[model samples]
Target: MAKDDSDIYAALLQAIERGEFQPGSRLIETELAERFKVSRTPVREVLNRMESQGIASRDGKGGLIVAELSQDQLGELYDIREVLEGFAARLAARHAAPAEIELLKEMIASGKLVEGEARELAIANKQFHQQLHNCTHNQYLQQMLSSVQRSLALLSGTTLAEPARVVVSEKEHRMLVEAIENRDEDKAEQVARNHVKNAYKTRLKIELGW
Candidate 1:
């Protein structure tokens, strides 16, 4: 695709992330074209691509809307995330170098353990996990993990946005890294599994208005 189309798609996705164009919101080609200063042709292409990528779905009657996850789908995604990511951690432990482990350790140590920029903290949290994923050496596993993470968009609210979440999350990250450094497969898998479980707990607490 052209540069303009790429930018428009990114802007649209970011808008969705920010709740500007929320889940189930319609995508009117003309209006989005005007908003992004792009031609309807490119806008249509972007919408088509988003649909194919599972980021959006056809509106049944016409165009497209951001896809929302059902309760069952959310549970399913979490199940897959824990299994795949835990496997990634186990694979990583077998392949990771000392330097890689050290880098992960540093990231865990330096990550904000208290309230701060939510987006930045979330990005850091994501990077730490992605780095662990990278250590796996299996391209297929890497790609599958990426797809599972994209499903995270279905859930509302940043896990990092909650007060005190970073503190708890940082400790969890440390355990994951330590397990990898120790080359303990069971510990790595357990730590990774617990991390997702804790994240789901946070999501539930927030959704329940606790």
Candidate 2:
């Protein structure tokens, strides 16, 4: 699309990810246009793009609203993530370059420094996973993982926001990276799968207020 349209689309998507426009909240084209200082045409285009990605949908009132995942849907998404990420970790154990491994180590170190900063820690966590996906060196796997990561944005609050969870998560990251470094594909896959499972448990605690 045109540059302006693409910018508007990205901005709108970021807004949704940041929970500015909450789940199931109606999205009026005119309101978005005014808020973004853009015209209705670009706003409409962005909304259409988001809808196609399952990020938003038409509400009962015929207006578009941010998409909300039911409990079952969230569970299914995590199941797929566990499988895909486990595979990625296996591949990374076999394929990652020395530099890539070094980068992963650096990411873990940086994550430790940012443990007290929720937003920074969240961004670091995302970067670490993204780098791990790239280390797999498979374009198709990377694309699927990227899509799953985007869907995760629909969920409000970072799992790392909990201080106790941050400690556990960092330890998991270290374990996964160590497995990759040792070229232990099975261990790497298992660690990655368990990491996702732990994340899901943490998500449940937050979602259910446990």
Candidate 3:
């Protein structure tokens, strides 16, 4: 890819992940080129790459829009997350350094200070999980999880938006960290899997307006 295409792609992807460009939002090549001070050619190339990655798709009206996952697609994504995240936790239990474990604990502590702030909590939660992914020390697993996470940006809102869900999620994070600290691979895996399961349930509630 050309430098312009790569830079534009990175900026567009970040905007999408940050909810600046929501699902179904139109992606006009001319507008993007204007925003990034680039030519239409590079914007077109970046949009093509995003479409291939399932991040953007033609809206059936000759324009590109951010992709939205169907119910079945969401189910499949969650299933992948449950298995891979559990494996990540198990590996972290075996390979994580003491300093890494301390950092996770510190992150949890910082999260508590942000209680009731949904956006901050959501960012912290992502950081914590990203750190856990790093703790696995498996580059292949990290790469896979990174892709899965990008897909997750398609979902509209944070499960942490609910006060009750936030409380339960923090507890779950503490339990998973404790399991890793104790070097109990089985417990860590189970805790991590259950965490994802609970998150899926919360996401369903949000999606269904329950």
The top-ranked prediction according to lDDT is 3
Backbone clash tally (model 3): 0
For model 3, the stretches where C-alpha displacement exceeds 4 angstroms are: 1-7, 112-116
Worst 10 residues of 2 by lDDT: 110-119
Candidate 3 lDDT, tens digit per residue, 115-198? 757767777888899999999999999999988987888888788888888888889899999999999999999999999999
Q: Which residue runs does candidate 1 get wrong by more than 4 Å?
A: 1-5, 113-115
User: Distance from true position, residue 23, model 3, in Å?
Assistant: 1.7
**Residue range with the least summed lDDT across 10 consecutive positions in model 3:** 110-119
Better of 1 and 3 by TM-score: 3
List runs of model 2 lying over 4 Å from the truth. 1-3, 112-114
Error of 1 at 78 (Å): 0.6
Better of 1 and 2 by TM-score: 2
1 or 3, greater by lDDT: 3
The order by descending lDDT is 3, 2, 1
When summed lDDT is taken over every stretch of 10 residues in candidate 1, the lowest stretch is 107-116
Against the reference, the lDDT scores of all candidates come to: 0.81, 0.88, 0.90
TM-score against native, each model: 0.89, 0.93, 0.91
